[model samples]
Target: MNTGNSPLAAGRARLGALSLAITGVLFLLYPLVRPYADEKSMQGAEAMASPAWVAAHLFGAVGFIFLALGLLGLRIALRETAAEPLASRAVVVTWIGAGLTLLYFGAEDFSLNAIGQRAVNEQNLKLLVELTEAVRYNPAAITVFGAGLVLLAVGVILAAVAVWRSGLLPRWSGVPLALGFALFIPQFFGTPAMRIAHGLLITAGSLWLASSLWRAQRR
Candidate 1:
């Protein structure tokens, strides 16, 4: 139960700190390289068919995974501290968020890629729009996806709170990261440029926090 000298535990702690840096880079690239267009048209289908589309979505999915891992690492680092409870809750919420987010990303990346390929092969671009709508509008898929994103926001906010009160870490370390997650859903309505900017914000925030976590681990 003590885990004080557990090699596996120590490894996880290290990886968790490193995960934030990886997540930051991936999140920054997700939107920048993504093929963006009006997804309701032929051009949209073409964009979807491109390798970049899949790569972009995959980046997002993988980023979420690493983000959750990083949060878990943070929780471990906070163990036995006053902030432990909040960090633990943050990990749970973020893990759930990452799971839900990945489900939607799976549909977006793989399913849509298939649909795009099929549409391109058939020379019937309308299929891309139709199929995409059907899949995206699925009640269950959307509900969970929405919930997941919101939970991500909540989880990060909790992490920020924990960091703020930790007394062992910089109070401002989690602010930018929390703000970035909080804006995740609303940014969907923004322009492509705005999305890119959003990515930058997340990148900065994540890297900042990652620096703190890395230092914490070394101490």
Candidate 2:
């Protein structure tokens, strides 16, 4: 009869879990969809125009959407539980950082890819090359995107620590969640393997949180 125990809450938990899981999988597959090396070259533009590359951008956009929704659900679930002040603040940071990161990526993936595709179709090799370089090595873009990722990672780590200390979620989940964010360091340096590992860890943590929320609802 309680709002927390309502079917709607249970459904939200399930949705959150599924979204996080899918987001992880999509991130894992990012390398496949990403442009091959020498992307700023004519060869790269040609490759970007390929069906696979376009599909990858589309998939990445969808993944970001899922990630945004998953993080929103996570924030709601955490708020529903009684948390320490630190944990509550961490939850807010987590959702804000997650939302910003997703928004940036969603727009970049969709719009940039569309531009690249159109440039290729129109035989604007010069424009395509310039755009590719900007996307890959533009200082401003790199800084902004990197900052967002760092914020998101830090927020996750903080939230995990709070959860661990506060028992808002299972203590076991917190450790891995923190570790997952720690792995983001390697990702920041552009290490492919670390990116995949980070995705796996975050996925595991999210599933664990979702399970906890579902159990809480039943109780």
Candidate 3:
């Protein structure tokens, strides 16, 4: 919206600030979740059912941070780029998808934490076994997993398109966001490899976005 010098420049400036803030928050979330990633905790369905491990995971907190940052950044990015029709549309859609995903993941995080906690304390390994088996055999986990994959896909698509059209960020930055999207899907359906791949993608994307924003300010 001609934000470079328009009255909305103030808002655009604010958006830039918000985006940078979110990027910083996301960076901080990494260390918070690191300590809980012990191998035995996630080894199998049995391990996953451990209340001590599951509750400690605090995975929801991470999802919440991402969701919050994504929502704020989306608002700012869209507002700043509104004049550019293509970028605006892409960003808006991406943000919407990202917002929904944030909600979805947030809910899942809560559910896992709450329910998972009970299983751990109850020592009801039997129930835990059943639930894990359901996740493996029943279609719900598959369905939900697919849904998460779709949200990530949509967000990445929108982000990729917006970044490409706006050229607001370096071409290098877009590369990681694009790659993150590509790797995220496979990671959802794959094994430990997927976790490592998706983790790298998330890290790369966050860094790129943060770097772009920092560089833009310097210019």
State which candidate has the highest TM-score.
1
lDDT of 1: 0.88
Q: Write the per-residue lDDT of candidate 3 for residues 91-162, one digit (tens) a residue.
A: 545555554445445444445454445566775656555654554445655555556556556655555566
Which predicted model would earn the best lDDT? 1
Candidate lDDT values, in order: 0.88, 0.61, 0.49
Q: Write the residue-wise lDDT of candidate 1 on 1-219 in tens digits.
A: 232424565567678879988999999999999998888777787888899999999899999999999998888877757888999999999999989988999999989988988887888867887899889989999999999999999999999899887765689999999999999999999999999999999999988888887776666
Candidate 3, TM-score vs. the true structure?
0.64
C-alpha TM-score for every candidate: 0.93, 0.70, 0.64
For model 2, residues 22-131, the per-residue Cα lDDT tens digits are: 76667556655566645555666666666666566566556656655665555555554554455556656666665556555654565566666777678677887676
Deviating ranges (above 4 Å) for candidate 3: 1-83, 132-145, 189-194
Per-candidate Cα RMSD to the true structure, in Å, reads: 2.6, 4.1, 4.8
Q: What's the lDDT for residue 165 in model 2? A: 60
